[model samples]
Target: MPNPSTPEFAVVCRFQGLFPKDIGGYEKHRTRNGGDLGHVDPTRSHLNRPVIGKADWAARTIALIEDMKAENFADEIETLTRRRRKKQIKERMAEGPRDPWRATRHGPMREVILTANRDWFDALPTAAAREARAQAFEDAARDWLLENFGGDVVHARADLDEQAFHIHAVIVPKVQVELNGTKRWMLQPSKHELIKDYEAAQDSVGAHFAPLGLKRGERRAEAVRKARQAGEEPPAYRQHVRTADWRKAEDTRIVETRAELDRRTEAVTAEEVALEQKQEAVTGREKAIGAREDAAMAKEKEAGAVLAVGQGLAAGALDIEDRDGTPALIETPEAKSGLLSKLRARMARSSSGRARALHVFSKALARLREKARDEAKTAVARDTAEIQSADETIVEIASRLPYAERRSIGKIRVSLSARIMALTGRDTSRKTPAKGEDDESP
Candidate 1:
């Protein structure tokens, strides 16, 4: 069915180029009179009838040959007398001068199918009426073929067994041409002027059906024509083949393509799996690095905390005092804050830590002993110098004193000398005028 905006039908005319090898198979498939068919309704096959001549292709070929035989083309067409098949002349260069691989190749035969996509015939009120219209439609197609193609339109039949009513016609292009420098006959269907190209054939067929109110089909080959018109290089042309052949070729191509795609997909999957394993290995290495960084950070934090505690002690905010030889807590309130208290508690945790602390205290006490000894030696040197100076002064001052005062000062000085020696553990006496010599006589 067609919409209101468009014509209710469009014409469809298809052409299949064939060789003698291909003709028998197509004929069998079309007529269903000799071969099997998949889509034909056998019950309705009786309705199928000849639109131009008989349904037999062989009989039609023979009759056509006889017609040509009776005419001026009788000798040229005698090549087909043996049969409506190829007459190959294989060249034998080894035996003669003819090329061995070279042989006469035949031009192809053409088959045309004429129908429309309109459901007008099927829209008839009754099956009998529909059947009558279908026949009439095919008859019109047959007449059109004969008028346009003449004797070349050898055989046509209406296939009513299919969904659409259509006519199949075989057209032979019998032309006389010089072959191998000898005159011979060939079926060069390209010689038909109506089918100069597919578009031309379609245009003529569409025009014929136009009178029946069917629209022309879209021009598929128009693009190629337009390209040529635009002065571009001609595109490679795709020759049309029978639908069955096209289907078979396409099926094989699709199967090969799918197999190639499957191989590529498997390769991609393997690569992806390898990439995932590599990523996992990289992730493991990253985790190991993170753990090492965490340990380093912990050590740094502990060192920072210990440094802060030492700074606090220098600021007099914290102190340590031995319980046996010292009095009270020496830390300021600032030093006993929650953070420092926690640090102190952590540091003083076990008996082992206490023992370590005691050993450290003993080392500090020994340092103090060395410091005290240095101070004591400085004091003893100062005292010894003072005592010597006093002894020398006594000798000078006694000479200026009275006899009595001299005797008294002498006794006191002697006592001082003995005490200086005892305290310093060294002699401190200075020389007195020989023992008996009087400073007063001098």
Candidate 2:
């Protein structure tokens, strides 16, 4: 027997295909209730009630059904009827059931309602607190569907104005799956699969809410099985058979658990705030380091440019002319002296002697130019070596910084991921990278 006071987590699923005549009745039940025009105080009726205005019924309802369109699930069936004879059969099937008033071949949709015991919300002191709790439960439940059903949930609404706060989620059972190496869509899920999925979701919801002092309640089927295993007589009303003494004991345990949970929640909230502050400080420091690195790189580039200009000037092939402010060639002292001697010898000889002197002067100038080029190449190589050595020293100094500084980068990434998981209640391990993300390792 389970205590009534302890919150019970329950998930109920039902498949529905509305017939022509049933459509009006179903719509009336969901939107309005009681007599034809609907009751003003419909909440008083235990059977049907007015839905909470805050519930996102339109959005939730849309989520449940939009995926079950014919285009998505009709491929497999359509492929089988590609031949002429089979095409005829497909046309007949498209005509639908002989009874026009009934549902189509795949039916309309399925409804899943996830709920917690009334005591869960009743225990909350404020309406705001209760609403937050309800919203959290609904979000968890929606995530459960997305995980197991591959995003089949189309519509979902939470009704707070009813007897209990519960979520009504509509789901299209269709899913794309790989079978025998072939990918195809399935329209219906097996009963075994649905039951197993529900059980898993039940466990998930229990774990998610445990930190808030909501424990998992025993199910009647599970209780009966345990009783049979122990060779004990099962109670007549297995679902509602908690004794006074058991209830009292469970209530005491819950109170103690709630107190502990509150303390832990407060501690965790404080820790989260501190972690966020640390993360921000780390980010600021990283940005400052990046700026310093950029400045250093800019200085290195400037030094390289200056070295190139100096090498060009030293080569004597480049000279800054004051008149035009442009580079002009400059002759070495030896070359200038040799040219003057050739000019003097040209006047003391025949035309052939003058030609010979002119050739000698040109040879001297060529040799001087070649010598200047060699000196420029040597200087460039030396400067490059020195620059490489400086780079290595800088890298070594960076690596030798305190271990805490190096570890801060990794810690920031880990903490950011943890915070995201805490807020969303999502498993970080299962998250898929967005499109265009590289799959290669760093």
Please give the CA lDDT of all the candidate structures: 0.65, 0.51
Root-mean-square deviation of every model: 14.0, 46.8
Compose the digit string of candidate 1's lDDT tens values, residues 94-208: 2222211113343356778888764766777898888777766776697789887887777788887876888888887787667534454555666787755778777887788
Per-prediction count of colliding residue pairs?
A: 0, 6
- What candidate 2 gets wrong by more than 4 Å, as runs, is 1-27, 33-109, 176-186, 191-194, 227-442
What is the lDDT for 433 in model 2? 33
- Predicted structure 2: lDDT: 0.51
In candidate 2, how many Å is residue 352 off? Answer: 99
Residue 14 in candidate 1 has what lDDT? 80
TM-score of each: 0.46, 0.36
Residue 5 alpha-carbon offset, candidate 1, angstroms: 5.0
